[model samples]
Target: MKPLSRVLSRTLFYLLVIFVVVYSVFPFYWAVISSFKPSGALFAADPSFLPLPFTLEHYKSVFLQANFGRNLLNSLLVAGGATLLSLVLGVLAAYALGRLPFPPRNAVLYLVLAMTMFPQISVLGGLFMLLRQAGLFNTHLGLILSYLLFTLPFTVWVLVGYFRGLPRELEEAAYVDGATPLQTLLRIMLPLTGPGLVTTGLLSFIAAWNEYLFALTFTVGDAVKTVPPAIASFGGATPFEIPWGSIMAASVAVTVP
Candidate 1:
């Protein structure tokens, strides 16, 4: 009876994990295969698991006609810039908030977390006006800066926890060695927080990459657009026609990175 119960529990755990992974990954897999499907195969009421006639037509269209390559580069720049900037600023803020003794640290941390709760749309109009006034409209720099509004808070929030988790002994030892605070952070503390940095940095990049509202509002031309907006703007020959193939192709392209 005990052995049977153990086997049953183990089987259920594996089954649950499989179900979760499939649920999470199925949509992307469908998009990848769908990208290769031709218009005929795509619209067929009954679609195959693998595209019946795999083709590169959508890829060709996306690159050759839609100028998606440029959009890809722009997205890469914006996302990378946002991630790097967030990491740099976040590390500094985290060290101060988490390591250095201070009054109102909890209040400050709560405020940062609260910043993330506000809807993006609530600030869009103000950001638009600010960007226009600063001559940052329709530019990569504008997008990167706008991304920091959301990314920086989350980055700082996560990194603060990481910084706080480090042993106080490490900092004391560094101080005993005549190391300055910045030197301690860079040489001793920073080196130990690799996992946290990578985790926050990757999340920041994905948030920036997948961002559509700010990208659409801030960027006027395809030249500065990111994948999400560029994908949204893809069109067909006729007004009534939708280009699902091109969209899936663009999705797969951006997703592969």
Candidate 2:
């Protein structure tokens, strides 16, 4: 009886894990497979799980006709710029907030977290006005700045937790060695917090890459448009027709990275 119970529990655990994995990854798998199918095969009576008689027509359309290559480049530039800026400012601010002993320190940290709760729509109009007044509207700089509203708080909050978890003995040792605060942060602290830095920077990059509202509102021209808005604006020859094949191909292409 005991052996049967153990076997049953193990089987159930494996089944649950398999179900979760398939649920999470199946959409991406389907998208990739569908991207390779020809337009006619996409809407056939019986759709196969795999791309039989695979074709590159959709990929060709996305690059040659839709100009997604340019859109991809734009997304890379925006996401990279936002991540770099966020990391620089966030690390400095986080180090100060987490390490320095200051009055109202808890209040300041709470205030930063509070800023993240405000809805984007609530601030969009004000941001638009500010960007226009600063001559940054419809520009890469504008999009980067808008992304900072969300990314900065996330980066700072995550880094603050990481910085706090680090041992004080190391900083004290650095101080005993006649190291200044800046030197300690640069040489001792930053080196030890590599994993935290990578985690925060990757999250910030993904946020900026997938952002839609700010990207759509800030930029107008194809020259500056990122992947999300560019994908939304994809069209077909006729008003009634939807280009699902090309759209799926573009989605798969963008998602690969």
Candidate 3:
């Protein structure tokens, strides 16, 4: 009975995993397949799982007509810039909070955590005004700065946890060997926390990449708009008709990365 129960449990676990994988992956798969189908097939009575007649017209439309290449570049620039800045600042802040015995350290850390809990919408109006006054409105710099609100807190928090988990003796040894604080961090702590750095940076990048509210609110021109807004702008000749094929194609293109 024990052996039978064990076998059944393993089988159930595998089946659950398979179900989760399919549920997560099917939408992306369907988008890719639908993107390849011609516009007519997209509106047919019966939808096909696979593209019976594959065409590149939608892909071409996205690149040539919609100018998605520019949008893609904008998103990369914004996300990359935000990630870089967040990592640099977050590392310094986390190291200080985690390693130093300064007064109000816990207070500062808790304050950072609290900032993350606030809804972004709560600050959008003030941020918009501030961006305009600072001459950052409608610019990549503006978007990058706005993204820092969330990314910086996240990076700092994650790195602080990682830094605290690191052995103190390594840092003490570096100090005894005549290493400066910066050198100690660069030579010892950073390398040890490489996984934490990668995890935080990747999360920051994805957050900035998918951000739509600030992208839509801050920018007016297509030249600086990210992929989220660019994809949202995909439309048909009239309000009544939506271009699902082109939208799906652009979605698949953006999602591939």
Candidate 4:
């Protein structure tokens, strides 16, 4: 009886976990399925889990009419640029905070963290004005810099912890070997923190890729507008519905990978 009870509890726990997984993933699963379905099938009274009549029409339509491909390219450029810049800058800043005993290190870190938490809306007007004056408005650099506002703080925070956890003896040994601080960081420290760096960079890319507010506010043309704002252009009032199938297709195109 004891063994049976234990088995039953384990089975229940597995079932609970499975339920949560399904709940979280069901919407994405539905969107994917709907994207592949014909418009008639998508609007059917009873939808099937499987794509009974799969078609690439929605994907083709979005690419052809909505210019989603161009928007996708813009997003990739902005997000990739922002992630690279943030990772390099964040790593250096984290290394300084973790390894060096600079004056007011704690105070500076606190101030940075405080700035990170401030409402973005509060600073948007000032940023817009600055970018316009700098002739960076509607440019890729502007998008990348604005996105840094979102990605950099967390990147610094995360890398600070990861760097602190690293053994300082490695740096000491490198110094004894006559390695410069920059060389030690580039050769030794960075190689050891691959996973953390990858995770942080990927999260930063995703955040910048999906950013809507700054993109919409800053860009005027499709040449620089990212995917999220481009998608929003489809939304209309007065029962003017979006093409759900095409939107889903565009979403999958952007998100997959």
**Alpha carbon lDDT of each predicted model:** 0.94, 0.92, 0.95, 0.88
Best by lDDT: 3
Off by over 4 Å in 4: 235-239
Between prediction 1 and prediction 3, which has the larger TM-score?
A: 3
lDDT of 4: 0.88
Off by over 4 Å in 1: none
Weakest 10 consecutive residues, lDDT, candidate 3?
Answer: 248-257
Off by over 4 Å in 3: none
Candidate 4 local lDDT, 1-257, one digit each (tens): 99999999999999999999999999999989888998789789987998779899988888887778889899989999999999999999988887787898888788768878877788899999999999999999998998888799888888888888899899999999999988988999988888889999999998898888899999997889889999877642336766788788888888795
Candidate 1 C-alpha error for residue 45, in Å: 2.6
Candidate no. 1 TM-score: 0.96
**Model 2 TM-score (2 dp):** 0.97
TM-score of each predicted structure versus truth:
0.96, 0.97, 0.96, 0.93
Model 2: residue 213 alpha-carbon error in angstroms: 0.8
**lDDT tens digits, residue span 57-106, model 1:** 99999989888899999999999999999999999999999999999999
Candidate 3 per-residue C-alpha lDDT over 1-257 given as tens digits, one digit per residue, 9 for 90 to 100: 99999999999999999999999999999999999999999888998999978999999989988779999999999999999999999999999999988999999999999999989899999999999999999999999999999999999999999999999999899999999999999989999999999999999999999999999999998879999999998889899888999999999888778
lDDT of 3: 0.95
- Residue 30 lDDT in model 2? 86
